[model samples]
Target: MSENIIDTGKLVEEQSDYLLSFAMSKLQDLELAKDLVQDTFVSAITKLDSFENRSNIRTWLTSILNRKIIDHWRKAETRYTDPVSSFFDQEGKARHWLVEKKNSTSVETVVDQITREEATMELYNCIEKLPPKWRGVIASKYLEEKVSDDICKEMEITPSNLWVIIHRAKLLLRDCLGKAEFQ
Candidate 1:
């Protein structure tokens, strides 16, 4: 039993980066992603007896991380917005404002002007400015690559609710990033 435990522990350590990256992709916050990864390992270790060899260890651990991400989102969404206030009421949805549509910009120009490290840092800074709720979903879904069903399950949200949150978050992120231009 002890030997089996050690093997599981080793496996977890070996796959920590993959798991962490997966969670970070979904959750976006490095600290929170790290916490979720650690928690997943702990949960897996405690439930080691359930390992029936039906699935790879990484898959099982990722499933756990997906759940954790959803839980994080649910808590964040509930905490940030009041149910009664209706700040994001469907009726009040913003109209599409493309007052001045422009052609696609060239990324090559920007890429050539900045070092990779600098560009990465700038993007990181922009991401850091995102609201917690928005950040969590982007991190988990985009960064972590967890499925929508898993995300919804973790956050205890309906698909519609998830869509609304994601939509609003993107708008906010766009506005926030726009502000960076002046600074």
Candidate 2:
């Protein structure tokens, strides 16, 4: 029994680098990625008895880490400040200050040629303004080029749920782009 435990421990240890890499790729924050990987290991150890052998250990650990990432994003979304109140006056009327001031003397030149990099950057900025879960769905569907079924599997959501998420994400992205003048 002790040997079996040691073997399992060794297997988990061997997977640490892969797990860290995966976390870092998804999170883009080094410290958060490290913390998430550590959390995954702790959760795996505590819940070892519950882990069925239907999937490999690496797959199970990755699933746990994915949940942690989603939880982190959900918390971030909750922390986001809504800009609606800022755009309205105390009387519930649209504030005049919300309108952009037009410059009459100097005409701004419209750039006919926008670099691909510039457009991509603008798209990313608009995507970032969306709620975190929406950003994840957009990234998985468009950036990662994953099929709907694959995205549904990865998100652990039903097909209908995946469609709903995609629909909501698209609406949010469109609103964000319009607000940011990136449309």
Best by TM-score: 1
Where is the poorest 10-residue window by lDDT in model 1? Answer: 95-104
**Model 1 score (lDDT):** 0.70
| Tens digit per residue, CA lDDT, model 1, 1-183 | 564544755776667877776666556689989888889888888888787666766667767887888899899989897665553346775433333333445578655544543334335545556777667777889889989998888777889988998898778666755554311
What's the residue-level lDDT of 89 in candidate 2? 78
Per residue, candidate 2 scores C-alpha lDDT tens digits across 8-110 of 5686667787677667656779989989989998888777776757676766887898899889988887689556776777999877753444543333343
The C-alpha TM-scores of every prediction are 0.45, 0.43
Q: lDDT per prediction?
A: 0.70, 0.71
Count the clashes in each prediction: 14, 0
